[model samples]
Target: MKGGTKKIELYDTTLRDGTQGEHINLSVQDKLLIAGRLDEFGMDCIEGGWPSSNPKDEEFFKRAMDLELRHARLAAFGSTARYSDRIETDPNLLGLVGCGAPVITIFGKTWQAHSKTGLGISDEENRALIKNSVAFLRNAGREVFFDAEHFFDGWKDNREFALDMLKAAEEGGASRLVLCDTNGGSLPHEITAIIEDVRQHTDIAIGIHCHNDGDLAVANSIAAVMAGAIHVQGTVNGIGERCGNANIISIIANLVLKLPETGASVRDLTQLTSLSNFVFEILNLPPDSKAPYVGRSAFAHKGGIHVSAVMKESSLYEHIDPALVGNRQRVLVSELAGQSNIRYKAQELGISIPEGGEQIRKIVNHVKDLEHRGYQFDGAEASFELILQKELGTFTPYFEVIESKVYVESGIGGRNVDQAVLKVRVGEEIEHIAAEGDGPVNALDKALRKALIRFYPEIKGIKLVDYKVRVLEEKRGTSARVRVLIETGNGRTTWGTVGVSTNIIEASLRALEDSMNYHLFTLKATEPKPAAEENH
Candidate 1:
C-alpha cells in the first residue's frame, strides 16, 4: 500500500474490557455473538477476551479458533508473567498461547509508580517481564502486542523510562507497541506529542489504548492516529473500567464520515448506527441518545430556528449527513415550533397542509400548547404521526374499538376459583381470552395480543419489547397523571408510541393501541401492490 493509502486497523476489545464494566457480564455464547458481529462489521481484530481470567473467555477463544472469521483475527489477551516467574513456566502465558488464538496481547507496567508499588518490583524487573512475555508469545508462533499500561502518565513522569519499555518490547519481537491511557487523564495535545516522540525513536507500528474518564477517549485516540498510530484500540459502546474506553463506534463513524479526504474508504459507514444499537441491545443496556454520530438524538432538531434551517437544508445544522452513519435526520416537534416546523412535520407524515395562510399558524399554536402541557411529541413520533393522520382524515381504524372487559375471581376455599377473564369484539368477531400473570399490565398485554390475533394473525408475532411508565406531577394528590411509553416490535421492525392519562392502566392501553395501529399503518403503506403494478 502507498504511504497515504494505508487503512488504520480497528482493534476492538469490547468482549474483554467491556465486560469489566459494572453490571455488564457476557456469557460465552454472548461473547461469540459479539465477536461474530464485530467481524461482520470489518474490525481488524476481535480481542475475544482474557483466557487466563475466566473459563468463559477460554471457551470463547477455543471456539472462535474453529470458526472461519472473514475480516477479523481472534486475539487472546492477558497480563505479563509474574515478576519472579520465568516465561516458560508462567501459567498466564501458557493459557493465552494454549487458547489457540493466532494473536496474543500482554500488558505490563510502564508507570514507575505501578512498577514499584503495584507490582512491588524494581523498574528493571518490570522491563524484563515485558520483554520476556513478548518474546515468549512471539516464539510460540503467535503475534504479540505489548500494552504499556499507564504509558501516558508514565511518559509524563518519566519519559525516558517509558521509551525504554517500548524499546524492550520491540526488541522482544512484539508486533505492535500500544500506548495506553490507563488513568484516562491525557489530553489530545499530550497524546500527539507522545506519539510523535515515540515515532522518532522506534520504527515499530504504534497503537493507542484509551479510557474515557475525562470523556476525551475518542478525541485522544484520533489525535494519536493523526500523529502516526496505525491501530486504534477501544471497546464497543465505550464500556470499560472507570468511565470507559474509547468508543470504537464513535471513532469509526467520525473517521469514515467526517474525514473522507484521508484516502480511506469506509464503504459501509451506513452500518455504524445499527451495529452500535445491536451491541447495546445484546448487552441489555439502554443506549445514550446523545452519543456522537450514532446516537438517536445526534441528528434530532427541536429548536424552532434549527428545525426550520434543517428542514430547508440539513447541512445547515448537521455536521455530517446522518445517512453516512446509518441514521436519518429527525425534525422534532416541541414548544419551540414555528410555522416552518409545523409544515415540515406535517409533510413528513405524508399530510399535506392546505395552502391556506392560516393553516400552518393554527397547527403550530396547537403543537406549542400541547407541548406546554407536558406532551412531548418529539420523542413520540408514532403519536405525532397519528395526530397528523387524524388532522388529514387519512387514518381509518384497522379494527373497531370493540368493548374490552376484564374479570377476576379469587379462591375462597380449597376449590380453584381464582380466575381472570378478558373479552373484546373487533368488527364482527367477538373474542374472549383470559390469563393470569404477576401484574395487571402483564395480563392486559397477553389478553390484548390474544384478542387481536383473531382478526390479525400477525399480532401473534408482535411483542412488547420495552415499557416505561412515568408519573406526571400535575395532578399530584387524587388523580396523578401517568405517561406510558410502549415499544413494540415484530421480528423485523420496532416502533415506539406514548400515551398519557390519569390512570396508569388507561395510559398503557392507549399506548398499546397506538403501537398496534402504527404497525398496521406502516405495513399497509409498504405492502406490494397488485400483480399488474408489479409487472409494470
Candidate 2:
C-alpha cells in the first residue's frame, strides 16, 4: 500500500462485484477462501460485500472476523444513508459500523438523472446523503472510501454536480473518492480529461472502478491512474455484472510492467497465470485461451516459421518472457506444422528428437496424415504424445481390447439404457466385463475400467471429466467422420486425448483408450479418490 506514486492502493472487489457476474454464485465459505487468496496475493483492500442487503454477506463478515490477513484490509460495501436528516437511524449506516471490517465503501448517486429517478431526491439531498454517510462511518472509527457511482455518466451529464459530489466526500472525511463508470460506456480519452478536471478541484486521492461493456475497463482504469488517481479498484479475471468488471490480473500486470511506479503489491507478477487459473477453477469456468499475458495459449506458437523463429530466439515471437507471468511458450503440431514444430513439441514432452533425422520426418508426416483424416493434435496433446512415442518405438500397449459389444435396450415409454460388454487382455490374462450407463460412451468407459481395474488398480480414480464430439465433413451428414476429444482426470491432473473415425462409438472408444493409456503411462496414480478441483 505504500511503494508507488506516493502509494498506489489495489482494492479488490471480486467477492462483491465479481459475484454479480452471470452464473457466478459464491457462498460465504467461497468468499472467505477468495478473500484469503486475495490477501495472500497482496491486495490492499478486499471488499467483503454489502452487509445490509444480504444474509450471506452478513454471515461472511461475521466469519471473516477471524481471518488473519497480513496486509490487506477487509472492506464492507454499502450505499449511502437512507435519510439525510438523521444518519444514525439508517440501517445501511448501522450495518457498515456493525460489520466489523476496518474499511467501509459506500456508493452514492452522482448523476442527476439517477438522483431524480433512482433515489427520488434533489441534488442537495443527495449531496447531504453522501457527506453524512461518510461522516457517520468515519465517526464510527471506520476508514471510508466514497464510491461515486455513475460518476462518469454524471460528469458527462453535469460536470459541476459530479465534481461537487466528490468535494462533499472529501469534506466529510472519505479517504478515497472512487469514480465509477457504472455503465461502462466511457472512452479512455474522456476518462483522462474528466479526471484531470476533477484533480484541480479535489485534493483527496482518486480511484477508478470500471465495467467491461465496451471491453475497455482495463484501459479506462489505467488512464485514470495516469491522470493522478492513486487507488485502483477491480475484480480478478474481471468477473462482474453484465460484461464484468475490469480484470485486476491484467491491470496488475500492466501496472507492474509498464508503470512500475504504480503497483502497490510487493508480490511478484510472475504468479499472474496461476492466480488467473485459480479463479477460473473456483468458478468452474473454462479459461480464455486468448486472454492477455496469463492464459493457457498466451505464448503458444503453431506455425512452423514461428516455432523455428522462437527456437532460435523466443523474443522473436513473444512479447515478453512468459516466465514474468507464469506462462510458458508452447509449440503446437498439426497439419500446418513443420519439422521444427515436431522437434519442439517432442522436446517439450521430454522426448529427444534427432535433428533432421528420418524419424522426425516420419513423425511429422504421420501427424499431417492423421490431421488430414480429421484428427486435431493441438486440442489433444495427450493423443499427440502417444503418437510421438509410438513413432519413436517407445510406446507399448498396456492393455488391448480383444472383443467389444455395445447394446441399446428398448424401454418403451421410458428412458433407454446402454450396456457395454468387453473382453480385454492385459499381458497373459484376460478379463470379461459388462457395465451399464446412461449412454454408449459412458457404458464403454465403465466397462473398460471394470475389465482392467484389477490389473491397473491405480486407474480406479480416473474419470472422464469432459467429452466433446465434432462432426467433420458436414456435407456427409450423419455418416461423416466423428472426432471425439476426451478429458480425463484423477482428482489431481487432467489430460486430453482425441480420436477420429467414421463411427462415433469407435472414435469415442479410441479417445477413451488414449486417455486411460496416457494416465497409466505417465501417472501411476494409486487408489480411488474423491472428486477434487484440479487442473493441468
Candidate 3:
C-alpha cells in the first residue's frame, strides 16, 4: 500500500500487446510459459490475449483455462461491440463472453477523432457502444475493465466528450476505468492533472496504461498513481507497439524502493530480476544491459576510484542494495583498474594476495595492456576470472595447442567456401578435426569444439548461447582489431569469454579456446583435493 494505502494492482499484458513488438511472435506454448512465469511472480491480472483476433490467441486462451493459477486471474482483451449490433447478438461481444475468463477488458473510443474517423459514427452512438458493451459483460457476471483508448489526446482535444465516455463506462458497472496514453507522448505533469480531473468526476477506481514514446512511461505511471490511480498496466521489459509500453519491472522496483517514504510494501522485490530474465528467455530476446534496477549493468562499476570506494563501502557508489533485486554488484577490470581493484578481484576468486606483492601491479598492467588491444573484461566475467587465476599461478591449461589453420576455396560460380583445421594435444594424445561452414569463424568454432570433445566429453554439453563481435577501429572495418565475446551454456550454468585480434578467425579461435578452458578450469577448482593436501 502507498499514498492513500490502497492495494495496488498489477496488470501484465505481455502476451497480448507485448507481442506487437517487432519480430516478437509468441506461439500458444510461449504464451503459456510467459503466463506461468507471471503467475509465479505474483502478478495480479494476466491479459492472456484477444481471443477474437487470431486462432493462436484463441487457442492460448482455451489452453490457459485449464491451468490452475494461484495468484493471477486470467483476462481476455478485445474491443467493444459495434455501434449497430446488440451485445448478445454481436459475434465480437459474444466471443468476449464465451472466452470463459473471469475478467474481460474492452476498449472504447474516448477521442472524438476516432469516433468520427475510425468508427465513422457520431459521438452519441460511440457512447452508446461503450455503455452497452460494458453493461453486457457485467450482466454476464464477468468483471469488466474499460480502457479509454487515447484518453489523454482525446481529453486535450475535447474534454467534455472524453469525460462523457468515462462516465458511460462508470454507469455501465465497469470495475475499473483505465486512461491510456496510447500515443505515449504525454508529460508527467499533464498526466497528473488529467488523472486528478478524472478522479474528481468518477466514483470508480482509476488505472493508468502508458506507452514509452517519450521515454516517460514510467514517470507518467508514477504521476498517475500519485494523482490517485490504484491500478497500473504495463508489459514486462516494455515490449509493445512502436516505442513500447511502460516497463513494469522498473516501475515496481522504483516504487517499492525509491518511494518507500510513501509507505509502499512490496513483499518480494528480489523476484524482479528473475521475472525480467524469465520473460527475456521465453521471448528469445537479449535483455537490455542498461535497463534500470534489473539489468546486468545496473550495479556494475568500473574505474579505480569507484572500485576502491565500493570495496570500502558499497553504499558509496551503489544507490540500493543489488541483492534487493536478486542481482549482485560487479567490479569491472579494465584499463581503469588499479592495484586495489586487482587485489579485490583476486580475493573474490579465493586467491590471497601475498604481503609486499608486486603481482597486483603486474596484473593491473597486464589487464590495461589487454584492454588497450580491445579485450573487454567487463561483460565477460569468466574470461576475467581466468585472467585472475593465471595471475595467481592457480590456472592450469587443459590442453596444449599444436596448430590451427583456415583454408578457403573459390568455386567456378565465384562462390567462396571456408574450412578450419584444428589440432590440439591433451596430455599425450593429439586430436585433429576439420569442419566446413559458411564462414571462417563458424568453421573454426565447429572444428575446435569437435577436437576438444575427443579429450573431454564435457565439452559436448557446452553449447554457444550468444556471439557478439565488435570492431575496435571502426575506420578499419574488416582489418580492424576485432573483439569477440562468446556465451556458452552447459544446461546448468552459463559463462562468457572474450578474445581480440586483427584477424577475425584468430579472434574467434581464441574465444573458443578460452570458453573450453574456462569449463575445464571450473571443473578442476570444484574437484576434491588430493589425499596428501587434505591431510596437511
Candidate 4:
C-alpha cells in the first residue's frame, strides 16, 4: 500500500459504551443482529458489551460464540481489576476470560484525579493495575487493548505520569494503547500535542475514543488520526452516554470522501445510509434527518438560491455527490422556492413539466400562498408531492370524507375518553365507523383507519410514528392557528405530512388524510399492471 493508502482500523463500541445511553437498551438478540450488520459493512472490530457488568452482556458473549462473523473480530470489553484484588481473582477479569472472544479491551485510570480522588487509590497502584491486567490477558493468549482512560486530561495535569501509564501498558504485552477523552473536554490542539508527545515516547499502535460533550468528538478523533492514531473507536450514529460518542459514519465520510489521498475506506461508502438506518431501526429510534453523510436532509436543498444553483451545477451547493454515500439530493418546495425549485421538485416526483410552462409558475405561487396561510412543505415532502400531483392533473381522489365528529367526555370515573365517528366514500361505497381512544387525535386516527383498512388493506401497515403541533400565530392566543406534522412509517419507509388550521382537530385530520393518501398513491403506483397491459 502507498503512503496515501494508510489503512486505519475501524472499531465499533455501540454494544458497549453506546448502551450507556439513557434510552438505549438492546436485548441480546439486538446485539447479535447489530454485530452481523456491522460485519457486513466491513467494520474491523465490533466490541460486544462488557461481560462483567450485566447478565445480558454476558449472555450476548455466550450467544456470539456461534455467530459466523466474516469481516469483524468480536472484542469483549471490561475494566482492569480493582486495587483490592489480583487479576486472577477479579470477577471482571474472570468474565472477560470466560467470554472467549479473540480480542479483549480493558480500561484503567490514568488521570491522577481519578486515581487519587475518584478511585481512592495510590498512583502506583493504578499503574500496577494497568500493567497486571494487560499482562494477565496477554498471557491468556488474548490480544489485549489497554484503554488509557482520561489520557488527554491526565497529560494536561502531569505529562510525566501519563506517559508512564502508556509505558506500563506497552511493557505488559499489550497490542495497542487506546487513549480515551473520557470527560470529552479536550480541544483539537490539546489532543494533537499530547498524541505527538506519546508518539515520541512509544512506537505502539495508538487508538482514540471520544465523547461528544463539547460537540467536538468528531473533530478531536480526526485530529488524533492525523497525529498518528491507527484505530478509531466510536458508535454507529454517535449514540452513547450523556451527549453521545463520536459518530464513526461522519469520520468515515471524512476519511473516504474528503481525504481521498488517505485511502482509508472502512466499507462500501454506498452502504452507509442503509447501515445507519438499520442500526436506528434496531434501536427503535428515529434517524436524525440532518445527520451528515447519511441523513435525509444531508443532501436536501431547500433555499431557492440553493435549489437553482444545484439544478445548474450541484457542486455550487453540494460538497459531494449524495449517491456516493447511498443518499440523493432533494429539491424542496416552499414559500422561498422559485420556479426552478418547483420544476426540480416536480421532476423528482416523476412529473414532467414543459420548459417555460405555466404549471411550474403556478406551483410557485400556490406554495407561497399556502405558506402565508401557515402551511410548511419543507419538512413534509409527502404533502408537497400530493399538492403537486393535484395541481398537475395527475392526482385521483382516493376517498372523500362526508362528515366527521369527535366527542370528549369525563365521567364519574375521572378518566377522559374520546370518541370519533367518521363517514367517507370510496367510489360508490360509503363506510361509517366510530372508535374510542385516549384522545381526540387518537380517536380520529382509529376511526379513519377502521373506515379505510378494508377498502385499502395496505393502510393497515401504515403506523403513525410521531406527531408534533406548532402554533403558527401566538397573537390569536387560544384561537391561534396551528401546524401539525405527522410522521408515518410502513415498516421500511417513513414519510412526513403537514397540515394547518385554526382547530387542532381539523389540522390533525388534514395531516392524517394526506398521510393515508400518500401511502395509498404509492401502493397504487407500484402495483403490478393488469393482464391486458402486460400482454400489450
Candidate 5:
C-alpha cells in the first residue's frame, strides 16, 4: 500500500546462494529450519536449493515437503540444459522437474565471454539453452523463472544479445525474467538506466540478484526497484559466495521504512532481528554487532553527550525505534558513561536506586578506574550488571569459593586427562567436587558445575559456547595479565561475560563465575525463587 503500482516481491535464496559463502555449510535439517523461518517472515518466494547439485539439497527437498508453509512458494534452482543435449533429455533439467517444487528457477550464461569460454558454446546456442529450459519447465506446469546470469556485464559488452536473451525467456513462457548482477560491480546509476532500458524493451516482470563484491548490491537492488523491477532476490545477512549477496534484511528495512512509494508489503517487521539471528545461530556464526538494522550496536549509545540526548529524546540520536525490528536500544556503560547512562542501565536491569547524586557518580568513577586497568564493559554487559548491582548494595553472592586445584596426567594407554578439584560454600553447606575434562579450563568448569548443580539444578541447562583469552602485557611474559571473555548459552539464549587478572586460570574463573551468575539471575527473573534460597 505504500509504494506505487509496482507490487514489490521478495525472494530469499539463503538456502541456495547463501551456502556458497566460505565456511558456510548447512545440513538438510538446517536448511529446512531456515525455510520455515523465511516463510513465516513472509517472503514471496523461497529458493530451497539446487536439487541436481548435491545429495544434501536433494534430501532437503524431500524433507521440506512435510513443512506446513503458509505464504511462500518453494523453488528448485538449476542451470539450463547442457549445450550437448536436448532440454527434455538433460539430466539436470529432469532433476528440477523431479524435485516436486511448485516453482523452478533456471539460469543460463548471458555474457558472451562466459558463453564462449566458460561453457564453450556459441552465442546462438546459449540463447537456445535459456529458451528451451524455460519452455520445458513451463510446459510441465511449474512456475518458471529465467535468471540471465551476468546480465549487466553482458549488456555492457553487447547490449543486443542481452536484450535478445530477455525476449527469448519471455517467448519461452518464463513467468519472470531475473537480471543477475552476479559480479556485483555495477553502480546504482548503471542499474537504474539498464532496468529502465529493459522495461522499455519488454513488458514482462523483471527481478534482480546482486552480489556484494563492490559493496553496492543493496544500492543497486533498490535502484532497480525504483526503476520498476518487481522482484528482489537476495540472501539473509548477505551471506553468499565471494563478498556475499545483497542483504535482504537491509533491503527490506530501506524499502519499508525509508522509501515512500516502493509499494512493498512486509509482514511482521518486528521479527526481522529474530529472523536474522536465527539464521546466524543455525550457522553457528556470531551475529554482526554493527549490521544495519538488527545488530547489537545498531542503536547502542556509549558517548556521554549522546546518551544524555537519547534519554531526553530517543529521536535525537536514533533513526528509528529499535523495537520496530525486535532490537532494543542500549546505553553502554564505560569511561564515557554519564549519570544518564548509569540511570538507564540500572532501570533496564531492574535495580532500585536511591535518589542520590553521589551514588551514581561513585559508580561512574569506579567504571573509569576499572577501564584504566584494561577492563572493557562495553561488550560484556553481564559483568557490568554484577558490578552495578554490587555498587548499589543489592548484590548477593551465589556461591563463595573456598579453594580450587587442577591435576594432569598421561595414562599408560596413550590417553591424557586433566582433573580439577573445587570446594565452595553455598549458604551454610560446603560442597567438594572433582571432575575430569579434556583440558584445565574444561575440567575446572566441570568441577565447579558439579559442586553447584545439586543446589542450583538450573545450572545444568547452561553450557559454555565460546572462550577467548587475550594477554594484556607481554613484558611480564608468563605472568602477563590476561583477559578472558566467555560466551554461555542455555540452548535458547546467549550472553557474554568477561574477567581479567594476572593468572590465566584466575581470569577464566572470574568470567566463568560471571556467566553462571548471569544465568541464575535470568532464571530467577522468569521462574519462582528456589526453595533452597529461602533457607539463607
Candidate 6:
C-alpha cells in the first residue's frame, strides 16, 4: 500500500458523513464499492458509519471486512459512552470495538453548553465520559481517534474547560486529537488562533475536521494545517448534513499541488477527477460543474479573447495544466465568439475549415445571428457541426421530412396519450407513420424513428435520453420563443442538438431533426462507404 507523507494523514468519511446530504443515499454495496475505490485512490483511512446507529451500517461493516483494500484502513465511528453507571456495558462503546474495523473515532461534547443541555451532564462527568471511552476502546486493541465536537466554540466559550477535555483524552491514551468545527461557523483567523493554542497544550497529534455552513470549511482547514494539524478528515465533494463537511476534493488538490512540503499527496493525482465524479455517479447526483480542479467547466474557455490567449500561450489563461488533474481545455462557441472561436472549434471537432477566409466570417456571422434568435450552440456542438457541414457544402439530408403533425387525447380510463404522424422520404420511397407515446416529444421521436428505420436500420439504436426547453422571453408568456435542447445516446456515445421557435412543437421537431441528422453523419463517418455518394 502506497501512503501519503506521515506528516499528514488523510481520513475520508464519505460513506458516513456524505450520506447525510439531502439527496445523497448509498446502499451497503455502494459504500463498499466506494471504499475500494478510495483505497485505490490512496486514501489513508475510510470511516465506515456508526455501527450502533442502524442495521444498514452494521451490515456495511460486516460486508466491508473482506474488502481486500490496498491502501486505506477502515474505521468505525460513534460517540463516547453515554453517561451510564457502567462503562463496560456501553452499547456504543461495544459496537465500536466489534465493528471489524482496526480504527475507532468517537466524538465527545467539548462545548460546555452542549455538555450541560444536550447531554444533561456536568463538566466533570463529560470529561470522565471522554476519558473513559478512549481508555475502553484502546484496551479493546483499537487505535482511538477522539473528535472534540464544537472544539473551537468550546475554546471560545471556556478556554480552560476545553483544554481539560484534550488532557482527559490524552491521559486515556487517545492516538489522535481532532478539533471539529461542528457548527461550521468559525472563520479562518479563529481557526488559526484556536488550533495553535490547542496544539501547545495537547500531547496527542492534532487532526482537523470542519463543516461548511460558513462556507469557509476549506479555508479554515488549510488555516488549521498551517497552525499545527497533522491529520485531516473530510468527505468527498463536501457532501454532509446542512451545508456540508469540508470538501476533501478541493482540500486534496490544494494540499498536494500547493502544500506538498506538508507531506500530503495522492498516489495518482490524475485520477482526482475520476474520483470526484465517481462518487457523484454512485450517489446518482449531478456534480457541481463549477467545482475546482475536477468539474467539467473548470478548464473550459468561453470568451473569444480567452480562447485566443489560451491557444497561443495556455499559461496565460489557465492556472495549471488541466491534464494534471485529468481535465482538458475546451473553447466554447456563442454569440460572443469571434472568428478565432470558429477556427478553434473546427480543429477541435475534427471538421476542416480554411483559416482567415470569407467562409469563416460567414460562419461566425451566422452563429451570432442564430444565437441572437435563441440558439445556444455552445452546449449543442452536434448542431454546430451540422452548420459547419452545410457551409462547406458537404452535408446531405439522410431522410427528408415531408410533413408532420402531433396531438394529445384523453383515454376512456383517464389515461392521456400523445400521438405523432410523420411523412418522411428516404431516397425515392415515402414512409407515413403514426406512433403514440407518453408525451409530445416522445411521440415525435418514435414516429420519426419508425419512418426512417426501414432505410437506416441503425436508427433503432438511438435513444433520446434528455429533452429540455427554455423560454427566451418570459414576459411574452405563451407567445414567447422557446429553445429546445435534446440529448441522444447510443450506449457508447452521446450528442446534443438544439432548436428554436415560438411554437414549442416546432422547436422540438427542429432539435429532434438535428439529432437524427448528426447520428447519421457519425454512422457514415465510422463505416466504410463511397465518399461522393455520402454527400448526396
Taking all chains together, the TM-score of candidate 1 against the true structure is 0.85
Flag regions of model 3 displaced more than 4 Å. Answer: 1-3, 260-267, 396-403, 410-439, 442-466, 489-491
lDDT of 2 by residue, 157-207 (tens): 999899888988988999999999999999999999999998889778889
Better of 2 and 6 by TM-score: 6
> What would the TM-scores of all predictions be?
0.85, 0.91, 0.91, 0.89, 0.87, 0.96
On residues 177-252, what C-alpha lDDT tens digit does candidate 3 reach at each position?
A: 9999999999999999999889889989999999999999999998988888888999999999999999999878
Q: At residue 152, what lDDT does model 1 achieve? A: 93
Per-candidate Cα lDDT values, in order, are 0.82, 0.89, 0.88, 0.90, 0.89, 0.90
Question: Which consecutive 10 residues in model 1 have the weakest lDDT in total?
Answer: 414-423
Each candidate: RMSD: 4.2, 5.4, 2.9, 3.4, 3.9, 2.9
Positional deviation of 243 in candidate 1, in angstroms?
Answer: 0.9
Where does the lowest 10-residue lDDT sum fall in candidate 4? 1-10
- Candidate 3 accuracy as TM-score: 0.91
Candidate 3 C-alpha error for residue 361, in Å? 1.4
Displacement of residue 21 (Cα, Å) in model 5 is: 1.7
Question: For candidate 5, what is the TM-score?
Answer: 0.87
Q: After best superposition, candidate 6 residue 89: deviation in angstroms?
A: 1.0
Off by over 4 Å in 6: 1-6, 529-536
Per-residue lDDT, model 6, residue 516, is 93
Query: Which stretches of model 2 miss by more than 4 angstroms?
Result: 1-4, 399-403, 411-415, 422-435, 450-461, 490-492, 523-536
Candidate 5 ranges with C-alpha deviation above 4 Å:
1-3, 396-438, 443-466, 474-479, 487-496, 513-536
Error of 1 at 10 (Å): 1.5
Single out the weakest 10-residue window by summed lDDT for candidate 3.
Answer: 259-268
* Clash count in backbone of candidate 5: 3
Q: In candidate 3, residue 64 scores what lDDT?
A: 93
> Mind giving the per-residue lDDT tens digits that candidate 5 earns over 1-536?
21346678899999999999998999998999999999988999999999998999999998899997899999999999995357889889899999999999999888888988998888788888888888899999999999999999999999998998888889899988899999999999999999989989998999999999999999999998988888999999999999999999999988888874776766799999999999999999999999999999999999989999999999999999999888999999888888888888888878877767688889989988887777878767889888888788766779977898888889679788889888889999999899999898899899999999999999998999989988889888998898888889999988888889997787888888898888887677678667998677
